[model samples]
Target chain A: MKEYQKSKINRIKRGQNRATYDVEKIDAILDAGFIGFVNYIFEGKPISIPMGYGRKGNKIYLHGSQANRMLTSLLKAKEISMTVMHLDGLVLARSGLHHSVNYRSATLFGTLKNLEDDLAKEEGLKCFMDHMMPGRWDGIRSMHQEELDRTLVAEMTIETASAKIRDVGVNDEPEDYNLDVWAGIVPLKQIAEYPVSDDQLKSGIKIPDHVMRYYEEYKY
Target chain B: MKEYQKSKINRIKRGQNRATYDVEKIDAILDAGFIGFVNYIFEGKPISIPMGYGRKGNKIYLHGSQANRMLTSLLKAKEISMTVMHLDGLVLARSGLHHSVNYRSATLFGTLKNLEDDLAKEEGLKCFMDHMMPGRWDGIRSMHQEELDRTLVAEMTIETASAKIRDVGVNDEPEDYNLDVWAGIVPLKQIAEYPVSDDQLKSGIKIPDHVMRYYEEYKY
Candidate 1:
């Protein structure tokens, strides 16, 4: 397994036992979620904004309007960090101190560069859409040149990444286990509901295979 | 409606139409989730970490181990920012440009201070637990003095916050709307499954009302 070299900045100090530097493990966590919180320093204050992203190998692609504040600030700063997390379950323990949540989270740090060329920017946008819903770009209306002109695309090369995962049941104090209190995991998940077709959709236009597949797999 | 005064830092630029400074709306968004992405600067690189929080009026409370890195750093920095987002649905459109997600998100900026006294810390911890699962603090075992001492609780005074919400359906371009393409909203929600009691739980002790209520309300 390939591991990201641990540095002073990326090391996990408190929960070292739950942390992993394995590249594949980190990437798997990233792929499971399309939304990531992108951090940027604004007026000397750090702020995070949730943004849609696509990952192709070590490069993460992000796009926003040309005047997007966070994207431009990140471009100026050169380096950026993004975090993705999925809450799996709620761990309710007999004791307050032992209450926890099962989750898989990944944090990535790297340098970001704007994709100025038309082809690169187009590809980046395609990746962004396809990553959100696989095979979504194939049948969509092609982008006009003016639309592409007003979009800013960026690519970040992952320099170092770390993933932390907790999937076990409740871990309570040994003595508290026998107490007359319930302890367990309340599994949580994000599921899709029935699709509501657009009111103006042309009659008889059926949902495509990719769209149906996403709904079927995610539906509760 | 009371509104957070618009400022250069808190204003939304890109999706200005969906932005609101209404205090009640922002608080509603905050109350829907207990975990927030907290931004902190480490070695000059801005990074985000998911932290559990509780809100009371204008003050937000957070707790972690006494040696928690993020909490200590935020206390030292004096000011901090955090964001919470709930994805409502996927807006599939005829064109990629019009694809988006229906969501309610809030970003809060404030100054954090460590709660030094035992009473304040205890209240903060209680708020944190109750916020995650309502009525959860009462039935659980009380915290011991040593446990309380080993925990670090911080209270942030929310100075300004902003929220953006999008709950509409597909928004394809006017020209593209008539195309023979499917478009719609695939609703998404986070839900809880049936509770799984701990293996070592003393048998015959039924799940309490609080747990049952939580599961009933959240189960998909």
Candidate 2:
């Protein structure tokens, strides 16, 4: 959530009856998950790829092989559009036609900037690691030069962004409302289970206290 | 799978050690989940959004409003690149630098054709419904003409596609193998809990026997 003008893309524009453009609401939805499908164009055609990304200081960062198509195209293209979304539940409507999903989605448009220097690259990697596990960065070995060179780190400025959401009861058309059809949201969620420790570790190396903290904090 | 020869795009190419080209293997990976981030571009800019999709024949189908950024941009562009991936586990190597995700992902390059007309839209909707719950199409009411006009149905043919997968032990450099770092895959999975029926269902209408079946038959 950077201090920038709110931007809304027409695609995520809510029609007459559905409109949601709240900033905190958008961040809350995004913080719930880690992976998003990123669609971009390389050489004038569209290429959508699945990627893991993290947000920090009004920017989103992604890393991949420099040889990869989507990343290569994006680098050359300089600009891109991305969406991060989560489907919370399946909305079962009384009228089959109204059946839809209860979801929260955020779409952003931005330019790609490569972090080529060593120090910046380290910070990018730190963001990546911390995103997955908040304080784990201090626990792991720092990225070495060669390993840093092998990865491509791209950052996108969060200039124009908006989040669209739909989370409510099923919208059963009047004619079908009392038809005895079962209707409601079948809540869906993404969760991390208990860690399965590495078998080769010394028998007594217990699960780190920090990792266990998430399990308790997260609602199953 | 379509009879058309499917070529693999080099941009989305998989590394020799990183590739899993088996069609069934790809299908299993795709079928294992329901939601993924979908990225695309509009006006030579990148836009990525997340959406739920289904696969049938040799193509992947996504349905949404005619105004979604990713969907609308994809519809107009016709040609698109898309990927659906799930990170199955974390592959930890003895060398921290070698750690990678044991995941299954598919990237496809193709054109998206909007499903026009009522009959085709109905069929597409059927494909979608059955994807989440088999036998649901027959159990639900058919879509009406107005409903068809309001929905956007599009499919991307799997022309040049490849599945990149990593599932087993860590790939550590020889010198680092004996460093005594604990290593293995931390398997991540989405487990399906017991189904909770809609409250409005008749008291005697217990979970349909068919709905009760998947819980016992599949892991997630």
Candidate 3:
């Protein structure tokens, strides 16, 4: 992990809205992410879209076609900001008015540029694969030069960033706490069920140990 | 589903872009969604935020603290445009260069109003809960009058709307497909895992059939 400098990070100092920072906690939350909800501007309006992504040393990589308006504009822009959020639970406060979401999110802003060469494109693809499945890239076929020519890979450094989180117990106003209202959190999580091997797998091919281990340990 | 006018929906159609859409499809996609990304000018630039939402017959319902800048300004404006999107799959084409995404999205234009009064507020709350969990309101306590007094609800009808979709396989330029590159769709889906019952539940409490049934029958 890179050391975060105060000047390099955006800080939210409001006590009532305190969930917007706490870097170590934020990094772990971001590392657990599978995708990001990318927000951008198009034709002078806002457009936000969910997209798959991977994080590297100090940058996040998201690749897709040049056809995407948001992606193309972002790649050619002066700066871009994107957020990755994990909605951990639904906070059902004692009072209806206080109900909110328990979530951990990280927002990063930086300039983005398309990955331009075969070697770099190949590395970016690995970052994408490893981000989605830690050990699957080496087991799959690698991309060739011509194959790299058609892909559009874009990378944005983690320049100005902030992590926000809210995980407190229900905060019912003092008077409402005695109203006999049900209050707590309804936690949500993501888990993979048993793996279904591909149809073309050889008969002798067994479910890999790591894959089986994930199913055994994670309840879905 | 309301019948959509083709011209209003296909305002930005790109013949070769499968992700570009016509009106009817946009309405269906929008109908399936319960939330939208609201982007409005804040301090001379756009600020996008994810908000809880609902849709009435022809209008969209969104509410928050009346103090929020985006909600207040948007409701008072002549028109505000918003976009909603769902990512379906990561299209990994034969070549990394052509990697794309299969998605369904919609953009709509409308004028909004801040809702008031007991009758409209109650109906709005019902729509919000139903949108969050289709059959959940009946399982929990209903909101009280005073609780409604502190909340805010707003509406925006669909004046002009459009929907776009991309649900195809790799569209590699012909030559790239035969270049020995791995290509196919990496499907993405949202699945509800087994529930983690509330810890404060009465001892020996059993999981309700409706909750269990929802998970069992859910395919994604």
Candidate 4:
């Protein structure tokens, strides 16, 4: 398995046991969710913003209006870091110190490049839309030239990454297992409810196959 | 309603229509989730880490091992920023540019103070546990003095904050409303599944009322 070479930058120091540098594992964490918390230095202070992203191979794609402050700052900085996490469950333990959450999280550091060309922007946007909902790109109306012109798309070539996963039940101290306190796992997940069609949609338009398929896969 | 005074650091530059500085609204967004993405400068580069936190009034509390690199760095910096976001749904629109997500997100800028006293630490830890699951702290075994000594709790006095909320339905372009494209929202939510008792729990110990209450409230 290919692994990202650990450096002082991407190394996990505190919870070394839960850390994985495997490229594929990191990619899986990134693909499981479309929203990532991206950080950039703004006016000498760091701030994080939640952004929707799409990944292809080692490249992550982000887009916004041409005047977006965060995207513009990221481009100027030339490098960025993004994190994605899925909270799997709550680990209730016998002792307060031992309580934790079961989660899968990945952090990525990469260099950014602007997708200024129309073709590149279109491809990036398509990847993004399809990542959010498979086949939705083909179902939606194509973008107009003016719309494309006003959009700014960025491609981040992931240089190094690391992921941490904790999937087990409670890990309380052995001595406390005999205590009367109850402990367990409360599994958590993000689920989709039934689709609500836009009131303004044309009269005969039905929920498409791709959307219903998505709902079926993620529905509670 | 009280409002957070907007400064250059905490002002929302984009999506002005959805931006809110109301303290109540921002606090509501923070209280809805326990995990927050906190940004800090690491080796001159800004990186964001997901951290569990609790809030009381305008103060946010975070605790980790004394040796935690992120927590130490945040203390050294003295001022920090954290963001909490709850994804509500996906907004599918007729055009790619109009696609968005329904979400409630808040970004906070604050000054940090370390909780070194045992009483302060215990109080902070209790708030953290109760924030994750109400009544959990009182139900669990109290923390040992050694545990309190080894834990580092940092309280952030929220100086200013801003939030953006998008809870509406699809807003397709007026001209494209007649198109054959399907547009709508697929509501999304984080839910709790049935709790699984720990394998090591004492034979007769039942799941407590607090755990059952949490499950009943959040179970799908």
Q: Sorted on TM-score, highest at the top, how do the candidates line up?
A: 4, 1, 2, 3
Whole-model Cα lDDT of every candidate shown, in order: 0.91, 0.65, 0.62, 0.93
Instruction: Provide C-alpha RMSD values for all models, in order.
Output: 1.0, 3.6, 4.9, 0.7
Model 3: lDDT of residue A174: 69
Instruction: Looking at model 4 chain A, report the run of 10 residues with the lowest lDDT sum.
Output: A169-178
Point out the higher-scoring one by DockQ: 3 or 4: 4
Indicate whether candidate 3 or candidate 4 has the larger lDDT: 4
Question: Which predicted model would earn the best TM-score?
Answer: 4
DockQ of each: 0.87, 0.39, 0.24, 0.92
Model 3 clashing residue pairs (backbone)? A19-A165, A150-B97, A150-B98, A151-B96, A151-B97, B9-B23, B26-B163
The digit string of per-residue lDDT tens for model 4 on A30-84 reads 8889999998898999888999999999999999999999999889989989999
> Residue A101 CA error for candidate 3 (Å)?
2.6
**lDDT against true structure, model 1:** 0.91
Deviation of model 4 at B180, angstroms: 0.3
Inter-residue clash pairs, candidate 4: none
* All candidates: interface RMSD: 0.9, 3.4, 5.3, 0.6
Number of the top-ranking candidate, with DockQ as the measure? 4
